[model samples]
Structure formats: structure tokens, C-alpha cells
Target: MFAWFKRKFAKSEAAPAQQERHFMRNRTGARMFAAARQDRLGTAWGGTPLTADEIVDRNQVVLVARSREQSANNDYGRSFLRMCRQNIVGPKGVMLQAQSMTARGKLDNAANQAIEDSWLEWGKRQNCDVTGRRSWRAIQNNCITSAAKDGEFMVRLVFGADGGPWGFALQVLDPQRCPIDLNDQRPRTGAFIRQGIEFNRYGRPLAYYFTTTDESEAGYHWGGKSYVRIPAEEIIHGFLEDMVGQKRGLPWMATALFRMRQLGAMEEAAIIKARTGANQMGFIEWDDGFGPETKEKDDEELTIESEPGEWRVLPSGARVKESNPQYPTGEYAPFYKQALRGMAAGFGVLYNNLASDLEGVNFSSIRQGTLDEREHWKDLQEWLIESLIEPVFEAWLPRALLAGLIKVKGKPLPAERLDQYRVVEWQARRWQWIDPRADVNSAVEAKNNMLTSPGKLIREQGQDPQTVWQESARDVAAMIEAYKSEGIDEATAKELVLLSMGRPQPKVAPTGGNTNEAA
Candidate 1:
């Protein structure tokens, strides 16, 4: 009896543990809830299992995602590009500023200017950047925008004789041409290459696969089995990864895809119904007189163009019912907003910014929402600097040095000393304060208290402090010249400017009569 009881109790006692283990299999249940119960819905995740590779289906994902982005009805895709414009690549893009690392010895001003000017001039040249578009701003925008939409961005350094025979030019490559095949991952070596990107054992990318669009238009190229291998140092790929060792990027729109499709369908339906102007539309049923083949006169003549408030003669025993199928009612806006909120979260944008709706928003809420948006934008800005801007700079600086476009201390700098000459910073999009006076007052206080400096404040405004000082000096000189032209002496005009500028000046007698006259 004891043995039988023990055997029976053993099974029952282990059931809860088995259930717990099953629940833990769910992606969220294990960590979120202690006694979570996950039901099997006969899906691949519940009863069946799928690996990450099996689930992602890389080839299909890229094709379908890019196709959907081109679709006219793809509001989410359009909004993503729009978000990229508003946040990532704004009006004035990420700016490069050179700074000296050493305190005593400042960088050669002329060399810094030459480097900046040469890059700007080169950026405007056709074919200088891979796209053959004549603007660095445009190139930066395209790369970042494409990355957000298409998952990855690729650019190759095109140097040597063919590419202008001077400094390097960049060629933006379409990722479709660079296939991410399984066979590429295998090697007798210590590296793994996937989708044209090669990675070392430590998971750092060592190379990339780059080629022009496949010349063969053969059979639609279903399985991308080929790509040209290129070193990683020659290519700049920009993408955000969720996992630590994610080999590739999942579409930024992936999370919102389902909801976006549903929302689009709903909006289209609403628009169609609204255009129909359907008002209490219903049919009069003939219970007794209607035959299978016969058509009623009233029903035949009754089209959507029928005049309203007209009394109609009906057949015998005709029953009328009104089926006012109301769409886009008071509930519609809130429901739509609720759906968009999720999309905005996925896109890392605020609801108002994503939807451009301010129906019920007040100052405090809008301010807070904008603040949250700024933080997200700032994060992206930092990412852009680290990934795209810095690498490009590192590549460009050496090329510029070799091309003799940049001269450090009036001489050609070696590759080894590039770091010393390459000391620089990039500035991202800046915002004007909500209350300018208040914000300025606070900044002034901060500056006076030594909490911050003028340079910091100027940079926050997206203006270079050195440039501001130089321009101010020029303006003061011009002002002094104008005063001198009006009969004031040179010293008096300079003194006036110095006094107005709040600089210490020697004591001077007051003007006798005219404002310009000095005693």
C-alpha cells in the first residue's frame, strides 16, 4: 500500500514543476510572473519549437520589407522615413569640429580649416560619395534613412586611379546585391562571414561582401548565393542591433508591422464608408410578393442617387428597417490614437510627433512628450557619431593627409600621428529652448557660477564658440569704423565699442553735445 501511494504521490507532486518549466518556455512568462501559465495554442512557439535562424528567414524578410516600404499604403514605412528626417537627419546635420588634445599646443588653425574646407568641397563633387549625389548631407541622410528602412547601410572606399586618382571616394552599395548565405559562414579559418559581412571569433566584423548590381537578370535570383568579398575596413555599415552579437539588423518596422497593417486596413475602410455618405441605408423587404426571378419597380429605380425626403410607394406588405452603420465616430479617434501609441513606442518616437495629433494635449504633457523624444533623438545622434561619423572621419583624415589636402604644422603628417591631428568632435541637431529668456538667464547663471562655459552654451546652440568670437570681433571693428567715419576719433570709437561690450576701459570725459562727440 505504501509503495503504491508513494508512486501515485510522486507524479502529482512533479506536475506543478513540469507546468512551471512549460510556462518558462514562453518568451515573457518566465521572467514576468512566478506562477505564469502558458497555454498551448498549437503555434510554433507553444507546442512546436523554432530556432532564431528558422524564425527570422533573413532572405524573405529583406525582400518583403523593402517591397512594403515602397507601397503607397504603407503609412508606417513612410512614417519611419519621416522619423529619420525629423530625428536622425534634420535640417542642419551632424557637424564636424576639430579640437586640439594638448592644452599648451593648439592644433594648427590653417590645417584644421584646410581639412574642413577640403572635405566639404570634395563632398559636393559628383561620385565622391557612392550614390553619385553631390552632397555629404544628402549622403549621410540617405545612409541613415536607408538603414532605418532597409536594416543595413553599406559604403565602400573607392581610392586609386579609377576613383579620381586622389583622396578616396565612397560607393554606397545595395545590400540586395550582397547575399547573406549560410555557406559563407563556414571556413577553415577563424572567421565567420554571413550576408557578405565577415566576423572574427570575438564577433568583430573583419570584412564585407560588396559588388555592383548582379548583371544576370536570370530567373529573378531567388537564392542569393554569391557576393564579392571586401575588407571590413573599406566598408562602413550602419545598423542598430538588439542582441549583443546580432549579425544583422531586423527591420525597425518589424515590431509595428502587424498593427500597422491592421490600422491601415481600418483607415481605408473608414475612408470608403465616409465617401459613400451612407445615411441610414437599409432595404425594404417584400415578405409576401417577392419572387426569385422578379425585380421590384421601387428597388430597381432606387439607386444611391435617389432624392432624400421623397415618399415612395411600396409593394404590398413591405417592411422597412434603418441600419445606420456608423463609422469614424467619437470612439474612432481614441482607438486610432491608442493603436498609434504602440507604433510610436516601437519607432522610439512620441505619439504626437508620430501622429502629429494634438487633439487633447496640453502644455505639460506636450512638453514632457517632447523631452522624451529629445532623449531618443539624442541617443540616435550619439549612435550616428560613433558608428557613421567617426569611422568616416578616421578614413577621410588619412586620405586627406596622403593627398596633401591637409598639412599639419605646415608639413605632411604621417599615419602614426593621425590621432594627434585627428582630435575632433561632431555636433548633432540642436534645439531652441521653450522659454528662451528663462533658459538664457539660467545659462548665464550657470556660466557666472562656473558650472558651464561660453563654449558649452554656444555648442548647445549649434554655433561654434570660436566662430562666434571671430564674427563678434569683426562686427566690433566694423562698428568702430562706422563711428570714426561719423567724425569720432579712432581711440574714442574703439573705447565706445569696448565700453558697450562690457570690457574694462580707461576713464574718459563725457561727450559734450552730440552722441558721437568726445570731450
Candidate 2:
């Protein structure tokens, strides 16, 4: 029985070896031509021998430094930034709302008001925006636009005596000055590992390396020790991450390079063809001409050099022929539109938004596209609020309160409770209804059924409900006062308000006529 078991085990092992030999043969016949015929050739994608660091280095130098990446801001990249502004920042940029949850169900209106007023005052100060050129809205637009164009933006906090415990100013940095190479000058605990960002073993960033001056400045050293180390706490980095463990930012225009460049070349060629083709070229007869074809046998071959804005003079008896390619510019539109559509996909924006083209787009199609695009914008807004805005507010809150620059309920807030007041809400960009009639009806029905709330709808519109209600109340009071001044009653004024809001008044029966006749 033992001998029989050994034989069975040996046969089982042999069967696997035989199956392995068969399995080793390529089962998928769709491999590339070169790998299919060769026994040793492997797939090209996985065959790359470089490590992650090497790959990043190559991408930094070769891809990030490309001319297209630099010019992207003035080129097609504008559309991407425009979308970011329209969907993320809107006209007002990001708005802050301080809601104190420490008060339990009841809002700490005084505390919230104090925090908001102080922050607003601090932001409105001259040079509050470190650049000294931008207002709050302008700086918000600048930071977002910079991140989109350059793939990353770094904001430095300059704290000093402008107001509060310490007045703070924000300065956005150029990514070019931030080096991505490792320096041996730091400790060996991986605390200063990786490019511009230095991280500890736990992978938390500690510092950043930045150059002393912009390279474009006059008398700037092209070759020198121009780097300075900045602590991570003083900086806010804004970037849309595309890969895990990616140390640097990459522009949204990176993937669209191939298509953008090709379209540019094609259109440039078309322009040349159109403009040059319009010029008439003539061949002169031998009567008394200098045309190459009309030159005498004894005379050297003659040529009329055509310079821009220079007329080509011809003798009598000359025959002119149109050398136009006759290719219509409209032919390039479809190709451009198709390429633009693909590029828009890479940008994560709708083609209609980027191209501003509504051709062939129905309500359902546009709505679907807008819904997906809005979701992505919302995600971006959340990231910005969480990563950039929240941290800044937290850093600013304690300092402002301790400096006695801000007061809660007309008294200085306790420093211990600073953390409690730090909890705040940021309103992101919102959209108006595409079809207000239907959407408003739906919203009304949902509200009546307790499926949604006014606050939720107000937030969806990128507004603070309290603010909206206050404004509306003020408007209603003003309307009543104006109607009273004109000898109209409060009820009539309120009815007018309803009528203005698209709620029509019911028809009344005539006083002395039949009800049927009135109807």
C-alpha cells in the first residue's frame, strides 16, 4: 500500500510539470508581432527596468520641462482654468461660514459672528493678500489657476504685525524655484527624502526646498547655491494628484499634448495654404520678361523672390494660374472638434464646456454631461477646502483669538476653546437650474413631502441659507414700506410678492354677474 501511494504522488507531481509546460505556451494569441514569433520576448510595458524614482526623474526633466507645458497657460490650458473658476470658485471664489457645534443643537450665533467678522477684517486689510495686487477673490482665482496651469501651487504664510495675535499674508510661489532633487545636507532618517518635499519615515512632509530668486529676474545667478529650506507648517500646497506617491504636480494639458500639437500644426499649415494660395503666380512670354520660364537661353535662369507684403511685378503677355490647394478650412473643423472632444475627456471637463459647442447636444445629453462634470468639480472643491482652506483657518484662528483681534459675544474668546471655533464650513461654487420650471417644481414637491430642505437647496445654489433669508426678509420689508407709501395695504403687497414669484392669483367671480359667465 505504501509503494502504491508513493507511485501515485510521483505521478501527481509529474502531471503538474507536464501541465506547466503546456501553460507556459502563450494562450492569448493577440500579442504584438515581435513577441508572438519569439520564445524569449516578453510584453513591452512590464519590461521597463527603471524604478519609480528614475521614472519620476525622467518625467520631470523630459515631460514637465517641455515647451508645451510652459506655453500651456497661454494656449489651450485657459479653458481648463476657466472651467475651474466657473465650477470651483465662481465669481466670489470660496466663501466661509463659521458654525459652532459646541452649542449643541442651538447655534452660537455670537461666536460664529465674531470669528467671521475678524477673519473678514483680516482678509480685507491692504497687503493681506501678500502679493499686494489681488483681493481675496483675485487671490483665490490666482491660486486655483496656478495649480491647474503648473500642476502645483505652493502658498507661503508670512506672519507679522498687520493685526490679531499675528497678522498673516499669503504668497503663492512659482514651482520652478522648488527643486525636486534630494539633498545630502539633512539628517539620514528619511526626514528630508524626495524632491522639493521632505518627509519623515512615517511619510509626513516636514519641509520644502525653494530657490532664492526667480530665474527670470535681472542679475539672477544661473549657477549658484540658490536654495533655501522652508518648514512645511508655513506652506500650503495645492495640486490635483493623478498618481500615488507622486512628489510633484503635472499639468492637465500634459495628456492633451499630442492632440493639441498636431491640431496646431495642421491648422498652421491650413493658414499658410489659404494665405499663399491666394497669391497669383504668372509666367511671362519671351517678349520682354524676367519670368523663369520666359528667360532667354543666353540669360541665366531668373527668379522673382516673393517676400511678405511684396508685389510680384510681371511684364506684358503673361499667363496667370491659380495654384490654390482649394482645401476648405471647414474640413479641419470636424477633425479639430473630434480631437478637442478627446482632449476634454483627458481634462475631465465636458466637451461642450471646453468647446462652448452646443451643436447636436440635446437636453438629456447636456444634463448627463453636466452632472458628471459637476460631481468632479465638487470633489475638487472638497479637496481644496479640506487640504488648503481648512488648515489655513485652523492656523489663523488661535493666533487671531489670542492676539485679542477677535472677540466672541463682545468679549475675548478663551484660547482653550480655539479648537472648537475652528470648525467651519466653506461654500463651493454652484450652478443655476438648466430648466428652472421643472427643477423648481420638483424641488417644491420634494420640500412638501419632507424629502429635502431649503438649506440643502440653498447650499446647492452655493449660498448660505441664513444670509438668503435675511436678504429676502429685508426685501419683503422694503416692498411693504414702498407699497404703504403708495397707499397699498400689507396684504396687497404680500400678494404682489407671490405673483412676482411665479404663483399666479386665482380669478375672482364678478360681483353682479353669473359665476358661469365670469368663468
Candidate 3:
């Protein structure tokens, strides 16, 4: 009886074990999730639980190298880069407007003007860059172009003696200068340096390690190169982050690179085929093996040149077979277009714009495409402003103030008011209308219906509303005064001013008619 009771208890304990194994077997066999199954289809999906940083570390070098090659050699690659810079930065670049206000909440016009003037001065070609070659606009261009090409750009802030008179300057470094494989542990703080960036336990960047020698120099990779440790505050690294906690940027063209290479190969092969077809007219065969006379003629390298509409008489029993290559056939256009469309989608651009193909596109379609792409450009413009422009301005401001480079009323700006002075706006260049007249009419109608304001309209044109109003007021006043000097009545001068400004002329009372009737 005791043995039987012990056996019964052991069987009960084994019951749960059997149930668990059965559950696991069912889960594996059915695969609660199709993607979780281990089959031939799933085998190709090498999905891993690697973090963003690890993925970037594994691919950044090759990605950047291929991206640069595409930009240098591929026509579409060059177009993408050009479009990014032209649309994001524009010829005039981003405009800065000082919005510093006094304690009374009124515009501090003098201080604002002073700051603007000083900033423009510092933006000159000889002042903005450490190399003294790039102006502020040129620096902006380089930053945008580099980001497009390398997926990131680094600017080192120079202060004090190295910063020239303003005590601030920007140094644009090649992203490669910061080695991607430089990883180590900090001896003092026990922090981690991954991809040349030193980070604390919380993953905040502390400093960046830049190689002393660039890749062009001998021994750049394993030549015992020294690294300069620059604090995180002094380095502005601009990149678009697509994943959470991504430490590095991937090239914009990374996904499209393989497609671009294949497209080039296809086009080259097609061209070669066309050229071969054009060059080789036909082939000739002898009736028998080369006779003594034919061999002698071949040995002498005798050849026949045919002109237009010319015919040649062939030897007896000799026939010609024409070569026709049907490569790059009717299917080629559609396939090439589809490939380009995919590439454009990968690059976040319109296929028509990238390929410059306007076929079958009406105004509505083109307008919609332009509008959609412009929104993407605007997003990037804002990113550029936040990532690169704002930081540089804030860093330069305090230094400029301390160095007495920016003055108000002939006195240097007080450093204590830096926070107040930092209140400013960055305006990116706006796109012009495809049809200016139609756009203007729409804006007027919207305004008439109280749907939009003059300020909003002015802003849409990439100008400050207040600035436009002020300029308009000054111009009208000057015009009115000049008319008065010419003996024109003030009422008539005002009417003329309104007329020139494109305003409807005031209604005049009909002769000998009631004013109420005119109204």
C-alpha cells in the first residue's frame, strides 16, 4: 500500500510535465505566429534582435563609401544631392530674424538691428569658417551636401583665440575623420566609447574621438593613428535618425545603392548592344574552305567600304547573314521606369523630378507631386535648422557678446541677456508658385473671405510680414510726399498711392446724383 501511494504521487507530479511538453509541441508545430515558424521561407529572414547602434556599426563604413561613389559617378545620385541642397538651403540660405523684446513687451528694434548687423558681419567669407574660405551660406551648403552624401556632418566650434575676433568659428570636418570602428572603455569614468563617440551609462554622448590623420593618409586604419577628444558640446553632429537610440546616421542612398548600380549596368549593357548592332552590318561566309586566291586576298588585308545606298556583288556560292540584336526591347522602357520609380521612392523623392520625365503628367499631377515633395523638403529644412543652425547660432551668440563683437547703442551686448537674445526665428526659403497669377488670385479670394491674413500671405513668400508692412509704409509715405511737392492734393496723392498699390479706387459720387445711390 505504501509503494502504491508513492507511485500515485509521482504520477501526479509527472502530469504537469507532460502537459507542458504537449503545449510546447503544439506551439512549435502550429507556430502561433507564421513568422515564428522555422521553415524554408523563414530561413531567408535573418532577423536578429540587434540594437540600432550595432546595425550602424556593422554597415556605416561600407554604406558611406558606396554612397560617395554613387554621388561622384551616378547621374541620378548627383541629381539627388543637388536637389537636396537647392531645395533645403536655397541660393539665399536660411534667413534669421531677431525677435528680442524689451521688458515692456515691445520690439527692441535697436538691439535687434544691432544683433542682425553683427551676425551678418560674422557671416562674411573670412569670419564664419575656421578655414576662412566659406561664408555662412557656403557653410550651410556644405553641411546639407555632406549630410546627403555621408548621412551626417560634423562641425567643431572654435572659441577664444582660435575663433577670430568674434571668439567663435565653425570647422567642418570630414565625417570619416571620426573613425566608425573606434570603440573602447574610458579608464577614468568607466564610460564606453563606441564608434568614436564616448557615452555614459545612460547613452548620452560625452565626447567624440577624431582621428588625427584622414583616410587619404597612409596607415589611417591600422597605422597607430592618434585621436583628439572633443567635448560633445563643441561638436555639432547633424543626421536624420530613423530608429530609436540610433547612435550613427545611415547614408540617405543606402537602400537605393544596389538598385542604382544595377540600373547603371543595365543601361551600359543596352548601350553596348545598340552600338554593336549599329556597327556590325552583316557576316559573310565562303562557299568552301579558304582557297589559295582567297587566302592571298585576306593576307593582303583587303577590305571594302560601302557608301550610302551602295550595293556589293558577292562571289559565287557566297551568302551574307544579317545580325539583328533585339536587346533593350519594348519591355525595357517600362522596366527601367519601374526601377527608377522604386529608387525615387527609396530616396523620398518624385520619380518625375529625379528622372526629369514629364511625359503624361498634367498640371494637377505635377502640382500634387511638387507639393508632396516640398513637404518632405520642408521637414528636412526644419531638421537642418534645429540640428545645425540653431546650435551654431546659440554657441556664437554668447561668445560674440563676451568679445564685444555685437553692440547695442555703441556698447557691447550684456552677456547676462543671452537668454533673451536667443529668442529668434529661422525662416527657410519658400517655393514660388507654379502659376503666380492664379496663386495671387487665390490668396486674394482667401483674404476677402477672411480665411487668411496678410501676414500669412507674406510669410508664405519667405518674407517677414512686419518687415513687408514697414517697407510698404515707408514707400507709400515717400511717394505721397513727392506728390505733395509736385502740387498734387493730399486726397489725390492718397488715391494715386492706393491705385499704384493695386487697391481698388474709391467710388466717386455720380455728378448731380445722390451719394446714397452711388453707395
Candidate 4:
């Protein structure tokens, strides 16, 4: 029996070796793909193909917690939050333009003005947000920051009695209210819950299952089941979807979280070392326990206090060795910059912007980096407009119209033409020129060549083009009147008004000779 068992064990041990050899022999094209080979280098590399929902369900909570902690404590993390808020939402939030038109294809200025004016009023802190504390800009700031830190932002719409005068209000909820692992077999209908989101046969979110009580509240348990079903239409969930079937968002800084933590710990250690070195003058060593023979306690007898410009004579057989500590070595700055560069790349931002270190960057490099970073910010801004702004406006407009809040000349707007009034154009915040002269020259070239328009240029500067045109016309008329009153001719007054408005004058050449224009 012992011999049989020994033979069986040997066979079992040899089987894996034999199988590995066989597998290697069949892999003739293994060199084509280094990663596919089961070689020594690839032994420790392993992965599993998980669905998007499964992966999100498994990692969302942990990633969000770590991201929040980092953003709260780490400088780079906080910088990222600030950058998102400022660049994506800006000081003034995204502006709205109503594009309602008459049947003759002309702009219905009356309806548009009424809608715009009412929207501006409704966007106030006491009217727009359910909590009555966050204005339109603040809500946008929170949405962007929350999405950057937690990977998603959730807002619930309150209407009728629960809302403000316009019968519309927004309630921002913590992403934690919707549990990540709350998968349940939702009754009757073929829908089911995955990561607190209920999906139908087509994977469309039908409803969200949110816990009524927060985890921080008293008597809260992980397994306790108290969920409120909110329909998908009523909830505005904003997240960056990386995959087609992704149900949840992964934090924007998830990839760099580990590096940020490690870098923070390293910086702390370096600071402590430098501080310790700066404070310690030297160390006193006593020869083999032969120290001062004072009546004080043994521990206190060896304790020597020294002050500036003072010298102390040590006891017999004692020697002082000056101490020197070299901390934050030459490699530290390079390592730190390289790590931050990697993190910045992960966060889709410029290293200079992320680290606020513009030491060696010139105009060209800084301009390129700023352009790339602006593109990233623009992408997020577009996402926010589509995911949150448009939907909220669509929902709010109908409620405001029905409640007789939206009016034209003290008369209520017709609710029958809701579709016409719903057409809106959002003007997002734009960056200022880095080199004003160069930028202006390029813009002039573009305008002269018909590559751009006045409206486009005005919009790029974060101003409404139509409003600018009206203001310009009004200012020019006023200027012309003022100039005419000063005994100037009508045509020259118009010309002076144009010149004052920064319009270039038409240069007339002399009779025959070629006119040379000064640059």
C-alpha cells in the first residue's frame, strides 16, 4: 500500500511538468506576443476577464473612499478637485440660450427673452436647489467635484409641493446612498438590481434602489435592507462611462491613488528627517556607564540641556560626536517630479498645472501643455452639460411653464409649444489668451480669411454673441450722437464711432503712386 501511494504521488507531481512541456511545445508562435507566452517572466502575471458591472461592483466603494481620503489630505488630490471645479464649471456656471423660433423661421425674441429671464431667476440658491443653500454655480461646482472625487454624482428632482415656486428643485445625494453591492431580484417584472441600479431586459436603468438611512447614522448595519425606489427619469446620474455596458463610474483618480499615498508618505518621512537633523546638534557618548554621579534619578543624570552660544563640560570619559544627516537627496526632487508627472498623466492634466511647478517651462511648452489640458477640461465640460445640465433644464422648463412662472410681458407662455421653447444652446466658459497680442493677431487673421465669425469669436470669449451685437449697436449709436453734438458730420461721426469700437478704417491710396502701409 505504501509503494502504491508513493507511485501515485510521483505521477501526480510529474503530470503538471509534462503538461507544461507539452503546452510549450505547441506554442510555436509564442514569440509573436511576449505577453502571451507562459515563460518565466510571465509566471506572476495573471488576470481575469470580468464584466464592467462586476468590476465596478467589486471596486467602486473602496476606490471612492481612498479617493476622498487623498483629496482631503494630499495636496495633489486637492489640486485636482480645485482644477475640476474651476476649469469645468468655472466661476460663472454654463450659460443658457433659448432658441425658440416663429413659424416664419425668425427668432421669437419675446419668448426667448422671457425664458432666459425666468431661467436666471429660477437658478438662484433659494429656488433651484431643494436645500435652498446652493445656487446654480455652486450646484455645478459640487457636481463636478463630486464626480472627480467619487466617480459619479447623483441628483434627485423634486417637483410640486416639495419644490420652489417654479415647482422644480434639485436634491444632491451622496453616491454612498446607493450601495454598490445591493444586487437583488426585483419582483414580478424581469428587472433586477445590480450595484443598486435596477435594469430591465435591455440593460436600461428602470429605477435606483437607494438606502433611506446613511451608514454614519445610529443603528446602521451593512445588511440592513431599507431601500427607496426612485425612477430613472427622476434621478440625474453623471459618470464617465469607459465601457459600453458599464453601470457605474470609477473614480477619476483611481489609477494614481496608490502613487499619491506612497508619495505623501515619502514626503512626510523626508520632512521629519530634515526637521530632526536641523534640531540635533550632536550626540554625547559616555564611556561604559561612567557618567555624572549626581543624586538625581539615573535617567535624569544623563540628560544634558544645551543652549545657543553655550558650552557644557561633560563628565569624565565622555566624548561628543558632531552629527550630520543628509536627507532629501539630489534624487528626491527628480523622483518626486517623475511620480507627479505620472500622476498628472493619469489624471489627464499638465504636470506644471498639477504640481504648480513652472520652473523650466518656456512659452511653447507651457502653451502646448495648457492647450492639451484645456481639451481635457472641455471634454469634461461637454460631458457635464449633456449628463446633468440639459436634462435638468428639460425637466424644469415644463414644470415652470405649467406653474405660470415663465411669462412674456406679464403673460404666461403657451404650454402647447413646449417643444419649440425647449431648444437651448449652452455657452460654456472659455480660457483667456496666454499671449494676448499673438492670440488677437491670430484671431484677426482667422476673421479676415473667413475662417471664423464674430459670433464664434465672441462665444469663445465666454460672451453671448447676440447680446454683444445688441450692446455694440447701442454703444455705437450713443457714441455717434455724442460725437455729432460736438459739431461733427454724420458720416464722420459714424466713422469715429466705428473706430472707437475697434473697427479698422478703410485706407484710401493716393491718386497714382503705390501706397505703402506701415506695419
TM-scores for all predictions: 0.79, 0.79, 0.88, 0.88
For residue 214, model 4's alpha carbon misses the true position, in angstroms, by 8.7
Query: Compared with the true structure, what per-residue lDDT tens digits does model 2 show for residues 1-519?
Result: 999999999999999999887766554453436544534455344544665556565665455555335456335656677788777778877788888756577777788878888777666636456556666666677777767766677877778863223477777677666765654435656465576677886768788877653435543223345567888898888777666666677765678767777877777788887777676454434545434453456767445677899888765555445464666556688888999899899888999988889999999999999989989999988977876777777777877887787786568887788767877889988988988999999998999899999899899898988778889889878887898889988889888877876797799856765766778
Off by over 4 Å in 3: 1-38, 186-190, 213-219, 223-225, 289-302, 308-310, 448-450, 509-519
Q: What is the per-residue lDDT of model 4 for residues 476-497, given as tens digits with 9 covering 90 to 100?
A: 8898899899999999998887
RMSD of each: 6.9, 6.3, 4.7, 6.7
Model 1: per-residue Cα lDDT over 375-439, one tens digit each: 88888889888877778778778877766765556776455667777887777877888677888
Query: In terms of lDDT, which candidate is stronger, 1 or 2?
Result: 2
Best by lDDT: 4
Error of 1 at 120 (Å): 1.2
TM-score of 3: 0.88
Model 2 ranges with Cα > 4 A deviation: 1-25, 29-46, 49-52, 67-74, 101-104, 125-127, 162-166, 183-190, 213-226, 281-322, 328-331, 407-414, 481-519
Error of 2 at 482 (Å): 4.4
lDDT comparing candidate 2 with the true structure? 0.73
Q: Sort every candidate by lDDT, greatest first.
A: 4, 3, 2, 1
